[model samples]
Target: MGWIEKALMRANRWHFVHSYRTIIAREKRKHPQDRERALMGAIGAASRADFAAQGDAQVAVLRHHGLSDGMAVYDLGCGIGRTAQALLRDGWRGRYTGADILPELVDHLRAQCPGFTAIVQRKLAIAAPDATLDMVFHWSVFTHLYPEECFLYLQDIHRALKPGGRLIFSFLEFEDPAHHTVFQTRTANFAVNGWSSVLDSFLHRDWITLWARQIGFAPPRFTSGSDTADHPAFWQSLAVLDKPAPA
Candidate 1:
């Protein structure tokens, strides 16, 4: 890209970030007591209703996977502690670690939810030791990642997870023909810097299972019909993978 194009992209990113900040500020003022609302807006939710539904959907998925109290949990791309907040509200006693790429969101979460640990994860690696975590949930994370990026993170996640550890992550599976048409066109000319544009990357169920198997994980179970997000970035299909423990 030329300097002028680079400058334009920079400006666009700034505008996008600034617009998000403004909406968050407004929501914070409107619902001063509702920290979840503020945090959801800070991350990407457009409205409090959407945030609540999405939170409930995520919690249901966790519960369905047999996640219970006292399990060590990691939330990848844990924007503004949404999953952390959900877990807390459900009375989970897990050791929760929330990691996100945005420093400001991480800092805010560190201050807001002092009980849980939050980190600004610059790399694809999760900050947990090998075979330590009971579960790792990546909400709307793989949606933004390219195939190579997804593979790198999956490798790291496999290293961090314990035997029998569960991995739950979301992706956009192009089941709809209309969506597939657009997804194919965008991915053909995809670029990393255009995350906001090319972030809705699609994945196939067979590919997910293959990737999981390649990384020593059991064949992944793909589920759809999760609650929808107002934002275009959040994917509807979720992949659940389990690390095999020694017999």
Candidate 2:
């Protein structure tokens, strides 16, 4: 299953490219046998699925923001296609594209459901061209991105979206001064693009809002409460951005 996990994770390579160093390596060390650790990992995955089933909050937020049936939707960094599956289950009767950086994930998705066109590609380099999609959703994807890479993807998102399209994403934020210094100095990997960094890149509401404006998006909304948002939870945020209507 190590190989399987590696392959599935590889599709979401950008997020894990040495970003999981401290965690995975530590697990391997603690459980040199790795069997016990693997079981724990399996449990964790099952728990995530259960949490999604109980209530896919992202779906609720998307629908509230204008998502509807038959819209061409792209689930970027779709790990194992859970959200994609949830979308289908949630009455999203649209042309769906689940794009990721790992071929293994697409393979698993295909093996599980051979209906949609799953593309193993980077979010910054989308499969469809400009103004092609009705909406683009990146649930928890941005939480894994480096600040620089996040900016790049925001630009890509601007180009990929159609006029009047919407883009939603979530990130980590430093709710207090204690987190500010951590995120600023930490470097998860040499690539300079990873989540293990100490800062709440997602939680830093101001910088993200300003950055979105730079990417042609209108102002962004954020906070740390019901319907607003908080941090360190399994999901740090659920940001929503929309494209302008054509002239």
TM-score, per-candidate, Cα-based: 0.75, 0.70
Best by lDDT: 1
Clashes of 1: 0
C-alpha RMSD between model 2 and the true structure: 8.1
User: Residues 1-247, candidate 2, lDDT per residue (tens digit)?
Assistant: 6999989877555554344333445545756774434323321233445635523565766676688887888878765566665676786777888887656556655664457778777546667888999888776566666678788888887888998988877665667443354355664442476533322244467777888888888777553323343222333445778788867
Model 2 lDDT, residue 204, Cα: 69
Candidate 2 Cα lDDT to native:
0.64
In candidate 1, which residue ranges exceed 4 Å CA deviation? 1-39, 176-198, 226-235
lDDT of 1 by residue, 1-247 (tens): 9999999887654343444466568768977998666767666677867765667667877888878988898999887766676676777787889987767678776776778999877577899999899999988677666677789899999999999899998877777454475466665655544534334567888888888889999989876643344222333677889999999
Note the Cα lDDT for every prediction shown: 0.76, 0.64
